[model samples]
Target: MLAPTHYPLEYHDLRLVLALVRGGSLAKAADLLGQDVSTVFRAIQRLEKALGTRLFDKPRSGYSPTPLAEALAAQAQQAEQALARARQHTLGGEQVQGCVRLTCSEAVLQALVAPALGAVLEALPGVELRLHGGPGFANLSRHEADIAVRLCQQPPQHLVGRPLATVPFVLCAHPRLLQGDGGGAPPWIALEEGPGEDPTGDWRRQHFPAARIAHSAHGLHGVAQLARAGLGRALLPRWLIEAPLQVLDEPTVACASTLWLLMRPDCRHIPAVAKVFEGLARHFTTAANH
Candidate 1:
């Protein structure tokens, strides 16, 4: 009883073997490999010697692959396909056929950006859009996202984009939320904190100094949700106010927040990024800059 020996196989050798099997003759295999017939013959002999077995039967008509050779040829085909798949993945980002991650606040994504997604997809056929909605910002310098949509008066100096929308804040409450609360600013549901003089604390104080505070929430959506649940009146952005939650009064804070489309300098030239960015700007630029 004896054990068959194992041989270390090279990728180049497997290629030649597959070529020989598929081409059915040494001359054709050499042509496939861009080598002379003698070189192909010598390489096949070396492979056979390494395996301690004859791979082909050299009949007068042509070469016939043995059982071992057939198995090895299948392995070669599998290797070819595997390499092809890997190549596709490697080349994925070299073109515009991959995904683009977009980060923004949950409120904005819901109110304005989310609805316009259909148009974004229609324009960029193969580009995938990954939307992440949260409070804290995604770092563009680290490539956390391809783009960011947010409400800011002064966007970070490192990022770049024009103002998308000049969203205004209005007092809104659910129809049954505070019907008979007896006016005097409808009791306030305010944001916990935000940028200078207004957005949360100052705006509430300056506008309705004598009004009572009903509830306070961390994020813009949370503040709106509090109002939606029949809690109290909330000062909210125009985009975030939906049905049932009717405006208690006209917008008092014009340009309370400006929607800015920010992106890293590196991604500015990418076709998908540039195209989507312009599309978003156009979609947001309407007659509603109040």
Candidate 2:
């Protein structure tokens, strides 16, 4: 046989192999790479052809890597680490420039981050911030986001985080709704405890078992709006209290949770990501003190 065809692995090829090794199957690998299963399959085929060797076995359970594939994947991981270190060194503090993705719950975004975004952008003129606001937490391990702001009793162990503030829960209602109800417990605008746990819901149920839930929302922003609309009384985070919505003194629950700013350890080394992280940390730190 002629000498085996020699081909060098590309950056994308390394990423693909590592993703497949970590994800175990094409579908999971596609999800990690943000590509379709078919695309990932074709890429694997191309990589195998280039190397002139079978890299994976099509087992019933999943794609199992061969001995050579595992060795190649290990090298790919080392390469990735080296590249990350190089980027960290190349992008110095003054040279901070890149896009940083930030993810957080909608309530936090509207009340905190969004309002202060102008100042953040002003400080880091060369950096771009992409904010994602939703109820669910973004998977940082999958590179879904570079930074995250989360309100929780305890943050994930894998992420590096700092507690920013203590979010206190308060019962609020529109002046008009309270006036119409005439001093008794007005119908409740309940907060729906979605996938993430919020202790405030438990506090509401434990304290106001007989209260009727006239309307419900999945987030603090939604519940605040419902309360503002004179729909019903809502137990909400104190930060959400605004014009027209009055905080009720009765049934004061000592419910609270900490707000945390988090990021993957590897991402913290990037200049742009670190700059934004510092800016936001300062914002929340100042807000908490006041």
Candidate 3:
């Protein structure tokens, strides 16, 4: 018999075993965990050796958990729950502490979420906020981030998501461009295909289907700059465009986008994640209504 501590299985090993059981195959488990098959196999071997029991048996259909493995899985699940509880207690129940990974767009990070989250950080000194800002959405289902702020037409079904607010977009032109002119010809430079798509380059096709682009960029900052330089009218989030840029008073051209907060259903209950979500919701709701 192997001693419990001799070939000890770490928390990750236990998690890998659980993933394998749930996924039903080495390759499937690896895919789920974002790991290679060899890594999953190694973890399983380590876990089985530690317990001196064969946890899984190969079958025609796929790998099946043995009776001993099933029993061990039940125990492991209980242990995992206990550990999670202990972690919560150690941090302070219902009070957020520790690090939280957040994903958002550059404009939101610089203009809204970052500033609002600064208040949260000040309130909770022990908490760490890891912000990832860019165009693409992070994979929350795989634990890529603990919380996400996304602007999307529809939220994914597997995760818990809430509407933060509906942010309005405005068509703005540089003061010089609109000085005595009628905002130039048609075809304004704009954000390419919504927030989920790339926000750079010549995106006139989507916003100004009939207009030609004088310049293009991959970020809002660049587009805003070009518009300010009288390159062309640009579509941008109202929050990101500061004073001096004149909003084109065309009711037919304006559009609104929905902002959403998303989190894995499992992590939604985490105090840290919950606190941030509440704070963001409150801030955005108040801003939008005002």
Candidate 4:
């Protein structure tokens, strides 16, 4: 058997192939790439001819990549990243100034992200920062966020997650709640009912296992509000409610939560994102230790 004649594939052809693989159909890929369907189809055909193999098999569901195409897709992804870095370098290295979108929990935003924003802005005046605060994890692999702060025991695989700090938990209450209570230690207000016994109520059980909860809340913020209202004592992150509430020494529990900064391995080479990552790492590392 003779080996097929190999024709070098251009970057455009590689991009078209990758788009088709991702979009699942020629028409969809065309829409994403802003090209006519015929043009996309022609590009795929040319790619197949050059490689001497069929790249896609059309099915009732959608276009599915063949084994060879699947293998090529991985290579194409790396090539695309390399090309982006090359373009950035060619742009005189000054173009690293731009907006970076970050996602993290509300507590993280308050404790770490908000404090570091000033330094980052001063260093890169052309760069802007947009923060997305929530609990659910953002998909960094898909570029949903340029960076993320999360609490986890293990960092995600294929992504760089550096340990920034270990946040400790503390039991606190409003001053008004403790006025009538004795210094010896008052009865506590629990957050939830109990764990395993009720999945929806486990959050309460986990945080306030000893206290008798005066009010039940669905989220930590609501629970914090209830605590402030003197409803009951609650366990909360020290960094979040430290300044606002009176820390109860008697019921104080030293539970720890790990803080991590997550980013794609490939993104570390992007100058703007890289600089932000470095800044965050330095800021959090120092903050965590202190």
Best by TM-score: 2
Against the hidden reference, what TM-scores do the models get?
Answer: 0.57, 0.74, 0.66, 0.61
Clashing pairs in 1: none
- The TM-score of predicted model 2 comes to 0.74
| Descending-lDDT candidate ranking | 2, 1, 3, 4
C-alpha lDDT of candidate 4 relative to the true structure: 0.67
- Tens-digit per-residue lDDT, 1-290, candidate 1: 11277777889878978878866788878866779999999999998888788888999988888887777787886786566446546767533444567888778778778887788678667677867787655556544577888776778788887887666788888887555756544667876665421354666687668878878876788888888887888888766787779986554754376778888675665556766787787777753453
On residues 1-290, what C-alpha lDDT tens digit does candidate 2 reach at each position?
12277786688998898888767789878976889999999999998888888888988998888888787777776776667557657876565566788888899888877876778778888787767797766667655677988777888799889888887888888988767545666899876756443767777778888888889888778888999998988878887889899998875647888888888786666667878888888887787688
Q: Is candidate 1 or candidate 3 better by lDDT?
A: 1
Worst 10 residues of 1 by lDDT: 193-202
Worst 10 residues of 4 by lDDT: 193-202
User: Candidate 1 versus the native: TM-score?
Assistant: 0.57
Ranking by TM-score: 2, 3, 4, 1
Write down the lDDT that model 1 would get.
Answer: 0.73
Model 2 clashing residue pairs (backbone): none
Model 3: CA > 4 A from native: 1-8, 14-82, 91-93, 179-187, 193-208, 213-215, 252-254, 288-290
Top candidate (lDDT): 2
Backbone collision tally, model 3: 5
